[model samples]
Target: MPTSSPIPANEFERVLDLIELDLDYTAQHESFEDLVKLAARVAGTEISLLNLIDSFTQWTISRHGMDMEQMPREDTVCQFTIMESDFLEVKNLMLDERFREKSYVAGDAALRYYFGVPLKTPNGYSIGALCMLDRVEHTLTPEKVELLKIIADEIVARLIMVQAINNLKYDLNEAKEVKKRVAHDIRGPIGGIIGLAQLISQRGEKNKLDDVLQFIKLIQKSGTSLLELADEILNTDVKSIQAAPELTEHELNLLVFKDKLEKLYLPQAKNKSISFLVNINPENGVVPFPKNKLLQITGNLISNAMKFTPVNGKVTVDLDLELKDNAKNLHIVVRDTGVGLDVPKMEAILNGTAASTDGTSGEQGYGFGLPLVKHLVDGLNGTLTVQSALGQGAIFDIKLPFN
Candidate 1:
């Protein structure tokens, strides 16, 4: 029997969870078809179906002696099956007022008998049903009913396995993306290390020992950053690819970040005869945020800006703190005076769909930089916006909240 309420209390959430499984609604699998066939045989019925019910549609994933694949929810007896915590058996559909008006009952199919058991999820939501149907009234013995219950449980188990497989596939894809991101992110730090090493080599006789030691310290920091990022992405023990790194409170030193950025891009800027500037509000000497993630975000943005800006152009980075709702928020703006982005490219970059484009210096790319920046910003519960025209310039504006 159906419950008094027309819809289940958790109907919306249950349906959404079902949809996320990404099941194939059609009855195409041989195993599913066999189970439905066995179900019909055990009940001595002419028809059977494995049906998943959403809010408005009953999707038949498997069937026996039927050509149909789906029906309106109002036309499905399985709708009542899902509503029930257990089996729903209407021995004579024509005699039940609730089902008498259904098209399958009153129309050409003329279905009269139905015996269904809810296919329960691990969380106890009845997402669908496995049922046997007939054109004439039929009865099930106690022993046959017990067999049907076992088969229904089997169907539920297989559905769960399907969901697990789907999730594993998604995880594997995420892992691949993480690898690409790691490779893309490590490039900047590695480049900094190489450049700093060259500077030390060139200044061996001319530079003071203290200056050489400073460059060595910079090289060590760059190498440490490179290693940290690689470890974070490669270490799957914490499921880091799926989880954002924990945010820190007043741990990010703005001064160190500013120094690192200048050390990284100053060489490149000078090589191209460009003016590069980094500005951090003195009031925000330290802020609450994940230092590594912030570095990754800003580093990627600066790298992109430097790559696209033509020789002799100017690139400026501004960082400030804002007080909103008594919480500290960080604002980052990276502005470049070079070849800017058009509408389509900007759209694609922001949406993570853009492919790699060559910079003014013909520097190649894997098209991962901006997309990775967008991802990191989103994981921080931050917002990123871009303003640009084809030839004028581009500005990337980011806002990140602090706990």
Candidate 2:
């Protein structure tokens, strides 16, 4: 019944993927196990289930009125339910050819008025079903079928959200691993750069002094960029940012940001032969974000642009304001004319695979950029979207709550 191939054994990733199954439903969440109980009670049914179909079995992830944990794939009502596109209702299983001889339906208890809605993964993989069963023959009106889909949608959303959180945690761990290796490996070369630069500066002939100094400058620039990349990894925790002394409500400091960015990035950007254009929102009016948090998020976006984009490519940043109903928000977008993403990176992010990217010019990476952006956005109840067309460019858009 699974729409996609059974999750590969290696990809099952039980440590991070199955958090909800391992944790009790505290006050914060009503677990799927609880939803099963509620469903059976509401319909006055003999059984209900939140089940996931594996390669060879229909496993009841959570059960209320049923003792069976799973059944062979061929015996599953879920398999038949999956054959249809939407919620299904068989008011009387015994009367139909499909169910008349099915052992589970004809066994110790009768099953009638059966309804189930399929649950799909965020990336469009069909994973399982939420179903309710009753013993008495009955008809489900169109409205009831609609209601079942609505409830099923809620179930899908909660589970997918749980899975998304799990995937983010995986990304954070992978980023950390990349960070550790990068720090351990880069020190010797960085030290050699500084030492060689010093040797050349102190004793090189005047005619060659300019070349030596230029080499020193490039080393310094590379070292600084590497340091900033490491800093981005360490700053993933949003709570580490100091709260603004006073939350200012005025036009944002464009000149201050420009100055700060130039000081932080001029050498690295120049090394890459990249040009940066930072523009403020027309409204420019600021809200209540802690300035350091804003800087970390946007600065990492810029850092990635400089790191991965090809030489001489242009990276432009823009901001806009959105007022929806009673709330205001900020939409900041950074786009680069770079060597864009390939199919693999896009699919990997969508399917929650490992995170890593090599920089152009063989600059290498610590692999923390977008993951850090995503974590900070999650902390603030915001949104981040990454768009890229192979051979074209990449654009990142982040939405932050304003007021």
Candidate 3:
């Protein structure tokens, strides 16, 4: 009675796991099917398979002249093929001592001649085999065996290529999404600048001297904001910008916060003939925080106020300090008299679900400023409060604890 050789259970399982057979090979690809057909034609065999073995089963990713998709590993000659580095061949399965007792060899289908080229990966794992079988005994020429090895190499190359293509596709899609986000961030400031420029040009044409100077100032401020935003986008590294050495509270207090605020909001207020006021409580002078982050939070809030407030409206920014429960808190408030929000609009704006809308002077917005402010406030371990009524204007309050 003939008996089959022992299986290399450990090595087989390791190779199976490394290739990740199911993910790398699937019948959906026509290339695999074509490879099987070519193998059968070149080897002069009635049956051919691109086989992958996983533990207890031999799966045919692609097959020619076979109706079955899989079979027990114990019954298939391909199982023995995976254990060999080079191709395995049997001139007559029924005459071979190792395979004559195999059920398929003695029974109905009567698989006889066999030639299998082990599919080896670059990392040196023989995952499975590219095999050919016939019902009658036959000898494969040296040329035919070389052809089988060539086909196996092609199969492995194609699989690697597919993986590369999938990775490239994923990277391309990620790049597109980043581009959209950057563009969304950039559009708001640019739109505000353009609208302010148009206002300046119109005021100059009509000789509206009183507001013309204000519009010009606003254009300068918006232009500066736009330039800073461009720098941030180009660098694409917020951590690097925030990694600068921290400043003491007293040092930050003396760093011209009032001047920065005036430069940011005064022009926008003047462009619309709106009253703009900034009151800093001198006693609540310095607080330790990242200057860039604080500037972003305040700048975005003030810019938003300028965008939403109407002509002859009022926008007030107040900075003060409060001692509560022995913990000092910095309170920043921006209040604007303009079209106010209802409940849903306020929620969407805070939650980043709101779509950007044009401001009172046909100004364009990307609806990203408030969400960015919300993110910054969260990072600072602060609280944000919004109070508004339809046509009654709105107020944004932020409270941050001193470090």
* Top-lDDT structure, candidate number: 1
- Alpha-carbon lDDT, every model: 0.75, 0.61, 0.70
Alpha carbon lDDT of residue 374, candidate 2?
A: 69
Using lDDT as the measure, name the better of candidate 1 and candidate 2: 1
Q: Write the per-residue lDDT of candidate 3 for residues 64-166, one digit (tens) a residue.
A: 9866455545567877887787888888998887778766688787898899998877767776789898898767889988998999999888776765665
Highest TM-score model number = 3
TM-scores for all candidates: the values are 0.47, 0.38, 0.50
Worst 10-residue lDDT window for candidate 2 reads 19-28
For candidate 3, give the lDDT: 0.70
Clashes of 3: 0
Clashes of each: 2, 0, 0
- What TM-score does prediction 3 earn? 0.50
**TM-score of candidate 1 to 2 decimals:** 0.47
**Distance from true location, Cα of 84 in model 1, Å:** 3.3
Candidate 2 residue lDDT tens string, 56-107: 3455667767665555444567766654567667778777666666666677
> Candidate 1's residue-wise lDDT over 1-403, tens digit each?
3322256677655664564454544323575877888999999999989888754446677888877666545456787788787699998988898888767888998999999999887777888899999998887999999899899999988887766775676556556657667667888998999999888788779988899889889999998888888777666433222322322221355665677678645766786678999999877555433343675577668778877899989999998877554366888999999899999988997897777776787654435568767876887799999999989889999999864
